[model samples]
Target: MLVPSKIQTMFAAFYVCLVFWCLDSAAGAELAPPRNVTMVTLNTQYTLCWDWDHTGNVTFTTQHIARYKLNSKKKSPIWSTVCKDILDRSCDLTLLNLYYLGIHVLRVRASVNGRHSDWVQKEFSPDKDAALGPPTNVILTPAGSDLEVTIFDPLSSNNSSMKELIPTLAYHIMYWERSVDSQASQTHQTLTSSINIVILPNLKPWTWYCVIVQSRYDYYNKGSNFTSPHCMQTEGATPWWEIFLYFLGSLVTCFLVMFPSVYSSFWCYKTLKATLFPSHQLPMHFKEFFGTSPGSDVPCLLTPESESELLCDNVTVRLEPAILEVHDLPPENLPAPLLGLKPGSSAQHSRHDSSSSGDSGVYSTGGRSNSQQPNTSQPIAGVIDCWNGLDAEQVKMQEMALVLNSRPKIPADEGIVDMCV
Candidate 1:
C-alpha cells in the first residue's frame, strides 16, 4: 500500500508541472501583434514601421520580424524574411528583391521569448503605394487668357525600382473660380512620358481661380490626395497694344479740348497788357506847341494872304485907298473893274463891254468875259500858275502849306515888334 501511494504522488506532481509549463507556453504565444503597420518611401529606399502597444498591466519582452510574398501568384508563395529578431518596430525593405508591377503581401509579428503573435498582414503595390506622395514644386502661371500649371512627379524612395510598376502616370485636376456662385470642374489627362507642363483654357479673364492636382497609375483607379489648393488669376482679355492705343487717344482728346481755351486766354492777356501800358507817345516838342490844355482859345490879329507871307512883320497896304479906286469905275465898265482890270485892255473884252454898255451892267464870272480874261489879273495869279505846272505831289504839298498859312494867327505885341525893329 505505501509503494502504490508513493507512485500516485509522484504522478500527480509530474502532471501539475507539465500543466503549468503548457499554460506558460500558451501565454507567451499570445503577445499582441504590431499595430498600425505602414510603408514609407524616401528616394529609392523603402521602410516598414508599426506601433508598439504597451497599454496593459502585463509587461512583455518583445522583438519584431517582417516578411513579404507576391500576391499575384497562384501557387503557394514563398515568404521571404525582410527583418528578423529586430528590437525596433521598423525595418528597412530597400534590399529586398521586388518584382515590377507585382502585388505584394507584407506581414509583421511580435514575439515574446520563443513564441510569436498572429501576423498583421497588408496588401501593397509599389506603383499605387509610391504615388500616394504629393507631387513636388507645383506652380501656376498666366498664358494669355489661360492658366498654365506645372508639377513634377511625386517623390518616392523606391522610384528607380518602381518605375516599371507604373509605366504611365495620369493627372487629375480640379479647379474653380473664387466667387460666390462658382462651381468646381475636374479634368483627367494621361501621359506616357513625364511632362510637367499643362495648359488650361476657356477661363474667365482677370478672374481668380483655385486649383489642385493628384496623380495615379492607369491600372489602378486609386489616386493620391489632392495637393494644397493653389490660386492664380487669368490674364485680361484686352491686349497691351489696345491699351496703349486707348491711352494715346485719351491724350489727344485732352490736348484737343484744352488747346483752344489756352490760346484764347493768352491772346486776351496780351491785349490787356498792351492797353494798360502803351509803347508809343507823341513828341515833347509837339505837346508844348499845341498847348497842354485842349480847350484853350487865343485872339488872332494877323491875316495871311499867301503861304510865303504867313510870318511877315511889315504891313503897309491901305484897304481904304483900294476901295476908293474901285468906286471910281464907270457903270458900263463895272464888270471888268470887279476883276481888278481896266476896260478895253483886249479887243474881246472891249467888244463885250460896248455891247453890254447899253444894258444894265450885271457881272457874271462864268460868262465869256471871264473866260477870255488873262490869268495875270488875280491877286495870286502867279502862284496859281506855278502850282498848276507842278507835279501832283508838289501840288498837294503846296496846297497843304497854303491851308496852314491861311489860318488866323495871334499877333505879336507892338512893343515887342518895336524892340526887334
Candidate 2:
C-alpha cells in the first residue's frame, strides 16, 4: 500500500508548480509598484524598507509579500516580508548577510492567496566601507546613571598596542525604531556626521530605548572599518530637591569647619590688647596732685604736743588784758571783748588772778595759734568812734596801730602792709 518515494516527489513538484501558475495568473491581474520604498546600509548588509498600503487588488498580510533577492549578491531569499504592525509603514531587515560591494538591483514582490504584486525594484550598494571584516561591536548600555554608546576599536586589543587604534576615523550613526528614518518627520530625530554620536542624560526613570552606532576609519589614515549598531535602555533621574539639599548641607558644613578659626582670632586680639594695657593703670597727672597737695601745709606737719604748747604760749597769754585795753563800748566792725574781762564802761578796776587767763589762752587756745587778732580795741576818747564808717585809708591806719601794739614796737613803714584784698 505504500507509494514509491520517486512518485511522491514528482507529485509534490507538480502540485507546487500548479500553485505558482495560479498565483502568477492572479498577480498579473492586479500588479502595481510597492509604495514608500527605501534602502538602508547596515555594516555589510542592506535592509530595504517600504510600506504597502493594500491599495491594489492585494490585501496587506505577511503571506502576500516575498523576501528581497538582489541577484548580484548571490544570496537566496533570506526572509519573506513576514512581520506586520508597521508603526509608520516601515519594514526591517529583509536582507542580511548578503552585501554587494557595488550597485545591485533591489526588488520586492507581493502575492495575495493565488495572486502576486508587481516587482518593485531599486539599485543600491551595501558596502559602507571598503575594509571587510566582521562588524565592530557597538556597546550601548547605561554608564553609571546615564545612557551612553561606546565604540570598541576592532584594532584595539587587550594585549595589543594602542598605536593601532588610529584617531583619524570618522563615524556616522542613524537609527529609527518606532519609525524608519523617523527624524524626517516632526517627531523624527536625525543624527549626522556632525552630531551622529550621542550620550543621553536626564532621561525618564526606568525607561527603555533603542539606539545604533556606525563608524568608518580614514582610508588614507589607515583607520578601521564600520561598526555594528548598539541598542540600550536606561533608568531615569533623581529628584531636583535632593540635589538642592545636598548643596545646602555642604555650605553649612563649610561654615562649621571655619567657625573655630574665626573664634580663635578674636580671642587672640583681646588677649594681646589686655597685656599691652592693663585695666587699672591711671593717668600720670591724677596721681601727682591728690597724693601730694594735702601734705604741703607746714602746720599739718607739726607734732600734736608742740602744736598744743604753741597755742598756749605765755607771750600771747600775758597780753590778754592789755591787748584789749580798748575794750569797746561796743565793737563797730570787730568782735566783743574777751570772756571774763571788764568793759571800759566800768569805772572800777577789775582784776583777775594771773593764772586765770592770757591773750593766747583766751584767743589762741584750741590750736588756733597767735595768727588770730582779738576783735576789741582800747577805749580811745574820740578815736574809737571817729574810726567808725571810716574810708579805706583810715581803716588801714587803725590796723597798723593794732599790730604795732601787739608787738613791742615796729616802725610804721617797716613790714610789708597789704590793704588791698
Candidate 3:
C-alpha cells in the first residue's frame, strides 16, 4: 500500500506542473506582441518605432542585430538591447552605430506585470530602404550674368554620407526669372553625377532669379524632395565687343577735347610777345631822345657855383602873449612893479614896442625879408601881444569880455600853427 501511494503522489505532482505551465502559456499568449516594427532615419539619426494597444502602464523593449550574423550558420547571433523598460514605443537606435550600407534586423516587445509578449521583428536595409534627403545646405551666387548654385550632401546616422553610400548621386536644379507677383517658370537642369556646383548661364542682368534643388541617385532611380525656393539678384552683364568699343570711344573723346586746348595754348604763347611790342627795331632818334645812350646824361639842376652858394636861412618865431584889445588900455591901469620899467616911459616903450605901434598891437612871429624897421612890421595873424600890459583884475575882465563879445571858433586839428590867431 505504501509503494502504490508513493507512485500516485509523483504522478499527481507531474499533472500539477503541467497545469501551471499551461496557465503561464495562456497568460503569455494573451499579451499581444508589438505591431509594425519599423526604422525611421533623418539626417544622421535613426529611431525604432512600433504600434500596440497600450493599457495599464505597459512598457516596451527593443533590440537589433546585423542581418548577416543571422544568416551565418556557425553560431547563434546575439541581439543588442536598444531600449529596455521604456514607457514609449519608439527607441533611438543611433547609439548602436550601425553600418549604413548593410542589412539590419530589429525587434520590439511589450511587458506588463511580470508578463511578456513575443517579440515582433523585421529586416531592414539602410542602404536600399533609406531615402535620399535634400541637400543640407544650398548656396546661391551671382557670377556676372550667370547664377551659380552649390548643393551639399546629407549625412547619415551610420557615420557616413549619402553620397558615399550612393556613388551615382547628382543634382537637379530648376530656376527661372522671379516675377513681381511671385510666379516662376518650370525651367529644369540636370547636372552630371559628379557635379555639385554648376553655373546657370545667360541670365538676365540685374534681375531676380529663384532656384530649387533636389538630390538624385540615377542608379537607384530615386530623388529627394525639392528644397524651398531661394532667390538672388544677378550682376550686370555687358559684351566684350561693346566694352571695347566704349573704351575706344572714350579715348577718342579725350583726344578731341585735349588736342584743341593744347594747340590754342601753344599758339597764344607764340603770339604773346608780338602783340605786346612791334617786331621791328626801334628808330635811332627815339633811342637818343629817351637818353638811354652812355653819353646822353641829364642836364644838372644846379651849376657848381650855385650848389656852393645855396644858403639855409635861420628863421626864428616869437610867441608873445598879447590880448587882442590891450592896445587901447590906459597905461595907469598896469602894475608897474611886475615888469622892469614904469609905464609911459621911453624904456618901457622900447620894451613894449607893439603897445604904441600903429599896427594895432598885433605882434609878429617872423619879420618879412624886406621889412627893415620895427614900427613898419608886417601884421601877420601869428601872435597876440595886446594882453601884456594889463593887471590881473583887468586881464580877468578882458578874458571875460573876449569870451562874451566874440563868437567861439574851432581850430583845425592838423599841423602845429599859432593858436592865438
Candidate 4:
C-alpha cells in the first residue's frame, strides 16, 4: 500500500501526545493527598492530633504534622505550631489559655507553603485533671421513709459530650429540729444516704426532718437552709408471730417440766384398773356395795378357830387343836390372819401355839398353834381329810333331815340316863 508521508508524520505526533498524557495522569494520581486527616485534643495544652498517612516521598515538614490554633472566628491563622515530626501525631499548643475554659475549636491544616493548610475544625475541652472544687446545684428529695440528696459538679453543664462528669464528693447529711429560740443542736439526728450523689433527700415517715449536704472540698450552696426538714414515720410495730413465738416457747418449757409425772401417774392408774379389774361388766353385788355405808365392807382377819367355827356353822368341838402343820402351804396360800399383829400380841404369843395331842403319822405339827396360825395355812392331808369327813357328815345330816345329832350329848356330869325295865 502507498501511504502519504504527511499522514505518517501526523500519526507519529498523535501517538507521542497519547503516551505523554498517560504518563501525566499517572503522576497526578501519585500526588493525591491522604484522605480523612483528623485532629484530636488530648488535654488542656494538647491542641490537636492527626489520623493521616504519608505519600509519594513527602517529608514530615511537608506533611504538616503540627496543628495551629486559629482565631476564634477561624478566619486568621495564628502561627503554624509543630507538635511532632510524625504525620499521624498529636500537637502541643503554646496558647494554653485558649483551651483553659469553655469549648475550644481547633483546626489542623497541611501546608508546605507556611500559608497554613485548610483548617480541620474540631471542638473539644481540656482534660479535667485538676482537683474538682466541690459539688453544686445540690438537691434533696424525700425517699420513702428516708432522706436522699445529691450534688452535681458545676462543670458538668457543658461536658455532656464526655462521660461520667459527676464529681467525686465526700458529703454528709445531718438534720436537727429547731429549738424555741431558733437554735440548732450539734447532737443532731443522722442518716446514711445512698452512695449516688444525685438522690440524697429521704427520711423515715412522720418526722419533721431537714438535711445538710456538706462536702469537704469547700463546696457550698448558700440558698439551702443547710438542714432539711424532718419527714419521719416509723414502720409498723413488731409482728404478732414474734409475740406468739415468745409465749409458745414459755408454754413448751412449762409443759416439759410438768407433763412427765402427770402422764406417768395417769398411765399407772389405767394399767392397774385394767389388770386388777378384768371384769368389764359390772358385778352383781354392785348395788349392795355401792349402796352400803362406809365400814360395812371392812376387811376381816380371823384366827383358824374362828374360821373353823364359821365353816362348821355352830358345831362345837370339845377340844380345839393348837398345833397346825404349815409346811405344805405355799407362800401365797398363807392366810391374811396373824398378819398386822400388834407388838404386844407378838410379845405374848411367840407367833405359835403348842399342842397337847400327839403327832399323827399323816400330818406333822410344825410347832404352830391354830390360835396363832393363819386361817388359810393348813396341811394338805388334813385339808383333804376334813373335806371327806364333812362330805360324810353332809350325807348323814341329809338322811336325818336335821341339822344336829339326836342325842346332842348333854353335859356328862350334869345328866343321868334312866333305863327302861
Compose the digit string of candidate 3's lDDT tens values, residues 91-128. Answer: 99778766767888988889989888898888877666
Model 2 CA RMSD to the hidden true structure, in angstroms:
25.9
User: Residue-pair clashes per candidate, as listed?
Assistant: 4, 13, 8, 36
Q: Model-by-model lDDT, in order? A: 0.58, 0.47, 0.69, 0.42
- Global lDDT of model 4: 0.42
Candidate 2, residues 170-276, lDDT tens digits: the string is 54554433334555552323443423235655545455555555454444432233344455556556578988999999999989999899999999989998999
Cα distance off (Å), candidate 3, residue 210: 0.8
lDDT by residue (tens digit), candidate 4, 1-421: 3467888898999999999999988655532233354443322234344544543323222112213334346565444445423454455553444433345454454544232334555555443322333335556565655545565433333443112432333445566543445554544755443253534233345454445554332233211223334333323244799889999999999999889989999999989998998757655466346544345463445669778777634666685333222232333532233223343232111112356223221122222233242232323342233335345654332222111111122332333332211
The order of the candidates by lDDT, greatest first, is: 3, 1, 2, 4
- TM per candidate comes to 0.40, 0.23, 0.48, 0.26
Q: Which candidate, 1 or 2, would have the higher TM-score against the true structure?
A: 1
Candidate 2 lDDT score at position 326: 23
Best by lDDT: 3
